[model samples]
Target: MTINVPGRFEVGTTVVRRHVWGGKVWSAMPYRVLEDVGDYLTVASWPGLRGLVSTTWIKAFLDDGHGRDQTIQELASGTWRLGWWAWQGTTVRSWYGLDAYFTVRQYFDADRRPLSWYVDFDLPKQRTRMGIDTFDLLLDLVAEPDLSRIQWKDVEEYEHGRRLGLIDDRAHQGVLAAREEVVGLIESRQGPFAHDWSPLPLEGWRTPVLPVDVRSGAVSSGLWIS
Candidate 1:
């Protein structure tokens, strides 16, 4: 389904994303909408920033109240830009765990191999008067592009989160399932992972993120700001 104006999140619009740790608000992230194409939109901190996020509000859901990340969307959309960038924040009712960033495309170079996925351990997003927000727990998981390797970063931090009751069993399991599911997609070469993900038309656009002092997270580093 395409996004129409009036109900659309227009380009150049600034949205607030908050960072959370152990269920408390640590900072607020301000980002700009770079593109608002029908199938997908891109939001980033700004140029030279390290993270990019894409996805839209929930299109539909079952009464069971299941709201997984757009891994399903990644499969169903069938339309993709041949890149593996991820963005932050969410609009649906939040889930408590890590956020998985899946890579369906890779850079076109001799060393084209890239990490297939990365998981940002964080609290689920929360809606506030200021804006929609989530917290970063500082731990992460990385998977080699070929799906042959996986590793964790900041293990101590995540352990701390569990001690604080932030990273609970449900959250941990959810994150694992997400990571496994995306790896399955890449390994099977299905859906968005089809066609080896050769580059498409991204043209001249970049992601933006707020400075560390003001706000920062997995996708906190970027080229421009809102």
Candidate 2:
């Protein structure tokens, strides 16, 4: 059987906040753009949910030239293998829950300007072990106007933990507040700002592209940024 695989993404750019969950009260995940192709893309996160994700699962947002913001709807999902540091310099390598659920959506601004972007995740149906992380970004359009700063807060929320009410309501509130704060800060400065939350790291991770050997269906060598 021939499986459909997404094409490779381009290098040196990242897309933020492509996936959103919930109906009216939505929770979203913003990812750091690793690579982008015409139809697909790749993202990376530091201290990721399951530690790391593979290149196949990351997908790009579809953009429509309309005013309404885009939304993501899951279509298919994929997984990744990750390695993490345990106690005393020990490393553990296993299948981490790094996947995406196929999605559809558009990107927009506060004024409802169309940015033409949509994002999706490739996740599995069965509950997989994972962690929850919060990422924050501060944009100063006044001084050094072109630069944006980011801060990441990693919180480990297991499936059991969530079920046990271990994921406090305050934690979720904090993320939403942070997002609003950034948006307000930008609006005050007459600058446009975008905010996103994800189980994935939105910044500080990089995946380099290497030459592929079609004969072997293997990549020669690639670089990864931590």
Writing each residue's lDDT as its tens digit, candidate 1 over 1-226 gives: 2133324345655445554432333345454554434333334342233332222212212323243233223322423222213332211111121123222223232233332544455444333332345544446666565556767676765566556554557666655675676557657855444434333332454344444333332233210112
- Candidate 1: C-alpha lDDT: 0.40
Query: For each candidate, what TM-score against the reference?
Result: 0.44, 0.21
Q: How close is each model in CA RMSD to the real structure?
A: 15.1, 17.9
Per lDDT, the best of the predicted structures is 1
Number of the top TM-score candidate: 1
Give lDDT tens digits, candidate 2, residues 53-75.
Answer: 11222322122323111111111
* Candidate 1, superposed: residue stretches over 4 Å from native: 1-8, 21-24, 34-41, 47-117, 123-131, 144-149, 189-226
lDDT against true structure, model 2: 0.25
Q: What is residue 4's positional error in candidate 2, in angstroms?
A: 36
TM-score of 1: 0.44
Query: Over all chains combined, what TM-score does candidate 2 have?
Result: 0.21
The models' CA-based lDDT, in order, is 0.40, 0.25
